[model samples]
Target: MSVVARTVGLVTANLLAPAPGGRLDLEGATRAGAGVPLQIGFDEIGVPLSEVTFVVVDLETTGGSPTQCEITEIGAVKVRGGEVLGEFQTLVDPGGPVPPMITVLTGITDAMLVGAPRIGEVLPAFLEFAGFGPTTVLVAHNARFDVGFLRAAASRLEMPWPSPAVVDTVALARRTVTRDEAPNNKLGTLAALFGATTSPDHRALHDARATVDVLHGLLGRLAPLGATHLEDLATLGDPVPHKRRRKATLADSLPTGPGVYQFLGPGGEVLYVGKAVNLRRRVRSYFTAAEKRKRIGEMVDLTQEVRPIPCATELEAAVRELRLIAELDPPYNRRSRKPHRRPWIRLTDEPFPRLSIVRSVPAGRSAEAIGPFSSRAAAQSALEALEEAFTVRRCSQRLPVVPSAEARACALAEMGRCGAPCTGAQSLEDYAEVAASVRAGLTSAAGPVVAALRARIGTLAGQQRYEEAAAERDRLRAYLVAARRTQRLRPLWRSPQLVAARRTEDGGWEVVLVRYGRLAGTSTVPRGVNPMPTIDALVATGEEVPAPSTVLGASGTEEAELIADWIEHPATRLVQHEEGDEPLAWPVDGAAKYPLPPTA
Candidate 1:
């Protein structure tokens, strides 16, 4: 039975549960703020590595898994740009007897734990001591384990959780070290290899300090790789070199929920994406596979990483999957069949600027742009067509203006294509009106273009210009095809998603993942057995497929940026669409979404 299932019965009727022991102390020393962590060495993300705060945390718990365990000890040390500022260590009295095995493992005895303040009494003070300011970030080793406990303890006490963001040093090691660097991830093993320093004892504070040292060592190595934020360090770990994960063991105790999962190769390439309502049960399914070697050869050969995000509901999980797929464009996911690839019609910024074909200009920085086409060739053809039909300039180089009297107001002016500015045939208002029409033509699709073409066709037929009218008809069809082939409107998972995976009892496993869409806070899912959609979908929106730059060398950097954006989306204060029952949405401004895939 899950430890969490057993502890549910421990809550008291009063909102406040009893303190674990008599009040530990009337705490006084002013606590520092928890600041956000940054890849201090890299400058692109703009978060100063020095100014950002890092809290190294370790928790002693009664058992494994926060859902099943109770926290007995919490230790932390705050550091800024590698400088230790202050620290917090406290003991929480677990109301139950300490299990013998746990006592031996942690050396935290019942005697040492007794008479200590319960998590409820000691938490607020510790949170205050952690010193969270607008941007403090936490650091831990295997952070999710500690983070989960902190979350649970805070929920039980009804106190505001002090820190929401964290950095894991283990993840840093995985990113920076060679795949063959270490066979094991035990703290002492990594510290010894990396020349990281920590107290000899395995106490909470010492462990936290060790993690910090190890993280510093990792940063010292990866800074040259150009990591400017913790996200870079956290995600840049080298993928496992071998295929397929080690078989799930009986030791793993899984949780049931909705989430997305990924299989990565040792080189850190995403091999596959899956989801499950119940994390443990879903993941277990893979382990029990009779044809595991054949059915999952790609996964086994390619996978070095496993990532999961938990969701409150199945729908949210699916949504998150779609978002990730869209954003990350993981090579394994479905490829977009858009007719044009970032094919856009650009209105040039220079004088005598005319409509032209271009592939992708920056977003929110347009020179009067419209439509992302299915192919660059399509955009080029469209531009050619428009240039012929309207004598808009096509050359990128500046052209000498002809004397208006001799040129007879150019072809467009004669046909009313423009306001004849060269010949001074119209007022500024007329010129403005013509400019608006040009923009409309660029953005308008087949239906409207056809309607305009039809009228023009009649006018041309009267003038006995049937050839021009027929050409106009063809242009209308092209626009319609482009629009139908490329325009995609789907729901957005604007919020950060959390995916949790653990070992399953059945040999195969399931995972529980959460999707906090852009607007809703969080929704908890019912325990059920089912596979989730895909992450490519959740990360699919508003992304540009990447190209290799001499600087970036093209191994999913574009995709990495997209994933990072999804992970680090700023807080969503208002829902674009209204919905109710969001579990954790209350700030006047939205809370920053988490971007780190692992809870390091």
Candidate 2:
């Protein structure tokens, strides 16, 4: 027999006999504010069933609908470890006479409630007796009806309702008790099956007593099926598949720390990579009903082993997870798969520089690179926007310092779209001036380019070329987005190195070192300890980063942007910064000031 069954069987076996130590308390208790319900944290392993206090409650109401009905009486029994601790029972005034149908069903007459206290007076006492909070679990048969009435009463009375964790014995009985064991999950049927001392009637106190016994019986049946914790009981209805749950042992070896975890398939291939604030708890959650994602379930079923990489802080774990996903290209990781492969638009180093889409920027010409746009399509749109505003040549051929007289001009030159430098129609000096304007539009100042695009959109709209005007608007928006991002990241790339720190919740310190926008090192200082020595040591031992060759700095734009965001977080404090010739600061109202073409 299960432990709960063995302990509580005697109480149920003797039907109609009062349980030992089951005493009803008529006096009311008082507690402070209606406390918030406690949520089960990711790091919480389990709350043992034996340690949980359950308050089996039942309410007598004037009508079936909570909105129309009023609570007439409150009855509750607090029990722990198959033993009743106390009971609360009281008739409430309900502010009106009992309905004829309610009186016929419950035998509660208006005369019987002559001088009863109101719900406002009775609810606070009942909540206090129930010990409302994490340690207590409220239980009832057809719990929705009873809890709904109580919630409605509280709402009507303008009283705070502490939303305690609730367990519906009806739901539990359906999951645990066989049809042969009980004809139905009703309070009376369950109470009779369990041989409860008190029989359930329409009255509040009797039904609450019966539900306490029923709750114990259901818990006993669930115990053998491994429902030994409050967390397990909460998910009893939607139990995890046994096959998947058997693999929960994989997390047994993982430490309770912030880190990255990889689920490996049979062939040692990484199936999924994820970061967690608590490695063990988060990994174990995959085997519980809490993890409801279908793709994740498939990945879990295929997982043969769990690999943990512990980190000192959440940010470090996040960075490591991103890097691992990029490196391994895990099949189950949908994000950061190609973190370093984002595209950038670059102006070539020829005598006549023309915009070209390139993944990596050329050395010493970081100023000529415009973006790390989300996709090639977005970069193309931005490129087209700049092309529309400038007279630079659009041809792909390499133009000489002096163009040959035999060189043929493309149709773009005939359409007046290009300067036609290849045909010597436009001189190098003239093209140079245009290239400088394009370069200026790409960086430092984008107002002229934005104005040109807006003007083109307005002219197109005036001509009733609305489709073309809408296309111009899209291109202008894409260009402004990329320009804003580039302007935001440029200052971080220009800085030689930066040291910053943020105070952790535990009163410790998380210090980070960045060299040219790349996270070079990180360390933590325990609470009450001097952080200066640790910060100095971290800075000295940090990786040496050479001067960045492109606008992307010493790392991919994504990584640089991540580091820059971390430095700008409100909690972060700058300690030291080695600025280049120019001060490391973003332009005041730079590309952000440029307006996009209006939709209409």
Candidate 3:
């Protein structure tokens, strides 16, 4: 009937026995037992559970479903370090008759809520009492029931729900408390098993209080397994397999900063590589149920350790991830692993030059190339378009200093597809001029080749040659995109050392240093950190990669292209540079006429 009477009755029944003076001392026994083998939960190297504020909540409704029923009462206890900080409790009119079964179960009668406030009146005060902080953890026994109702109420009331980290005591108990300790993971049973000071009586506040005790008890059980942080508690509620849980320790030492991470498999092979704004969080996510990809799950199952490489900014992390994936060629990476293998559209350097598809950039050749196309088919398509527009020589043999009169011209020359310089049908100077026009078209956007191809497509379409028109259109689109990309990359490729910066989300700056279009170094200036010193330090430490003796290789060509794309991003502004910066001269007319290839 009363709290003290219940306590005395428990003592009389020997559940809580009297101490030395023959007077009941529940506080003494609690204090004595609370210190006994306190299982420390997850290692709190980043943010400990003790530092997190929790709002343990419970709700009583007219029925089980939030949509069908209505919340009759709400209760919450704000706690940190097992000490109560604040509380919120309210009764609300359900706007209808209280069901007899519900009233019988919760003892809440419509008469008692006659003039009580409704949900709209109660939710604001409850949210205010819960407070607002990123560190806040919302706790509830069978959390979905409470949180779901609250969310529904917020939605119906047009109120904003600040989604805080949620911990379900029911899920926690299932993971932490053995069945032997509690027959069923129910609030009343768990409360009784854990020696909760207050027993659950189906009233919201009383149930919430009992759930709070259960939460502490379950957390104590979890400490032995090193599940102590607020994030740890939030993550464990899911049905993550035990083996995966064990691998979570791999992320324990990872720094909480922007970086790239690799999951290493047996024999130290890199299984996967990824970049993240927070190294620790991202690595931890791989071990959690949040990672639902079956391939990633298998990779995680075989992972032996997590390797983190800290970066100065998200941009640095991204570039490093791309470069590492290219270098290591991890089997799990789906893209950017083997850049050298991608096809390139090369303009052969010869008296009668022609467009050709090549694997490597021809190590010593000085010919202009416009690719790194994903496949030879794509490069071939672009070459066909260039040939159709320029009619340059297409024979793939070394021509003699003086052409022989007996040398036969190919059918392409008779069909007017090629200039037939092989047989001297076209003069060497004339063929050279055509090749030069093709080179200019391959290296710049909206050049003669593009203009010719576009005009040809228009003429074909105007004549109702729909199929031919579409084919020409596709070819023109591909050539223009490749050419524009090459134009954008030329400046970076020619510069000996290029430094640039963009403002970061945290009111900071991200500085990127490039050499020959490849990422050489990157650093950041945090919001309040004096940017000049950080910039100077970054420049000092950066490897001033000299102007590469040879052309930019295909090994990191995709990375170079990626950097160019970032530099061209509408949001990015060049903040600093070793050499003067020039605006990327993209065609205002080309993209409108033809669709360009999407950047990687």
Candidate 4:
């Protein structure tokens, strides 16, 4: 058995060794030395298959169902570098008579198991022998059965089950071996086909040994197809179309750094845009079996090139990806695709200045806008809340400064819902006061809005109108959410220039420069180095932004919000600016005084 193991080890070593130029070839086996070391200098995507300790496990059970059945015997062969490391075999007393059928199949009768250790004892020994964690790969012919029985036994014994990475030889055989080579992926059939020295005969140890050979055979077949790492084993049978797999070369040139990657079609059209902490790894994964998205597979089919735009930090990569997705409108990239479509609640440019839902706030009137609400419906709900609080006109019609008698009141005015400013019932001076209140509610002072909504909710609740009260509560909640967002974001957007820094994992400094709430530049200072010079250089070379024309600043509202979130992150430290510049601070009491209405 020892000599046979050495021969199998030699065969496996030759089978898995990379050919000259770091490619595996079935016909190039003669070029490999007897004990060739595993290839070096490859990026560590996952544990190398040659270095992984695999425990080929098999179990004899009293019944088919793990929940109802008891494990009779356990057998596992631990192997690494194609050599047998150790073996674990033990019989477990089920504490019940084995059924005639199970006894006949496994040949483990009650007489043979009289003094065998019970599952509580056997399970601990098996776990200790199998080892734990990433270095260990658990292999079984049909892993579900063996692993299920083990986990059940552990549960029954109240033992901790270390769930290790598993490889099912049945699945692997189906992936690597063809129907012509083997009629079906069964233990007996595969053992014969792979020429295993031990033949499975309904016993645990014999079947586990046969499975070790089957596992090696399957890996030998998968090696030529580029499934050499432990991570590759998980997606062994992935039906990644050849066209998409071939295009993986596009990622070969990308750097392993934080960046935005654009998948370009044949005509140079951007197919998709994405951000990743490691450009090379992320883009390369699209071609591997692990990338199972049908849409992404289709995108890869169309992708003739992958273009990388490396950034200094992850935040920069995220911002650039957002901007590119919005700019290119890549068909395959979802989310953040339409920055222009984000809805905003704006006071229309008119004498009445009714609340309106607009896509983009007109250049100079962003202060009159309260939101880049998540959706048009949310903006509408907030508008209703503002209208409920303040008697500003709900009409969409633009009215002149001095209304003609022909301009009759709308139905809202007739119901006394509006102040009837259009019909001249309310004087211009009085209407100005109403507009001022609405503006204050949207921006600086939301206390009045919250108080009014709260009072309305109380009155409705007093009438036992719970449903209406709930509706008002939702409206107020929406208003408060939008108001709070605006209050936090407005200050950041209004700042002429702001600098912030955060400590990196390596004690380095990740510094960013913001101009009007848009990320202008970023730099990293190495560990144990002076960050001041780098920060000063970053500020001096930062993109020059003009005075913001809108409350959203020079960028889209989403971009401004992204910047605000970064600035407010707990790790971020604001660098104080020279005197006379407005301090980078949100109003302490802004909208904080306006508590949201309780759910009814």
Candidate of highest lDDT: 2
Lowest summed lDDT window (length 10), candidate 1: 17-26
lDDT of 1 by residue, 52-74 (tens): 66667887888886656788877
RMSD (CA, Å), candidate 1 to true, equals: 23.8
Clashing pairs in 3: 40-223, 41-223, 41-228, 42-226, 42-227, 42-228
Model 4: lDDT of residue 185: 84
lDDT of 2: 0.76
User: Considering TM-score, where higher is better, how would the candidates rank from best to worst?
Assistant: 2, 3, 4, 1
Model 3 Cα shift for residue 447 (angstroms): 5.6
Clashes of 1: 104
lDDT string for model 4 (1-600, tens) is 010111133324322442111111111111112323222112445344666777788999999987898988888888887888777788888889999999889899999888888888788778887776556767887776787788777767777666666677887787778889888989999999989989998788889989988888888886656555544555445677656554655665678789999988999999999998888777767776768788988888888888899999998998998888788888987786665577878787766778888877654665577877788777888888899888899876787777887888888887877988887898878888888888888777887777878898899999999888888888888888888887777666777788899999999999989877788899999999999999889988999988765556677767777787787899999884422123455455457666666654
Clashing pairs in 2: none
- Per-residue lDDT of candidate 3, residues 126-212 (tens digit): 888888565566788887678778877887898887765567777777776787887898899999998987899989988988888
Q: Judged by lDDT relative to the true structure, which candidate is superior, 2 or 3?
A: 2
Off by over 4 Å in 2: 1-53, 79-86, 95-114, 134-137, 192-199, 202-206, 216-240, 245-256, 288-292, 544-551, 580-583, 594-600
The whole-model C-alpha lDDT of candidate 3 against the native structure comes to: 0.70
Q: Per-model C-alpha lDDT, please? A: 0.49, 0.76, 0.70, 0.75
Off by over 4 Å in 3: 1-48, 64-69, 95-97, 148-158, 163-166, 171-185, 219-240, 264-272, 323-337, 362-367, 447-477, 504-508, 525-541, 553-555, 569-594, 597-600
TM-score of each: 0.37, 0.83, 0.78, 0.78
The lDDT ranking, best first, is: 2, 4, 3, 1
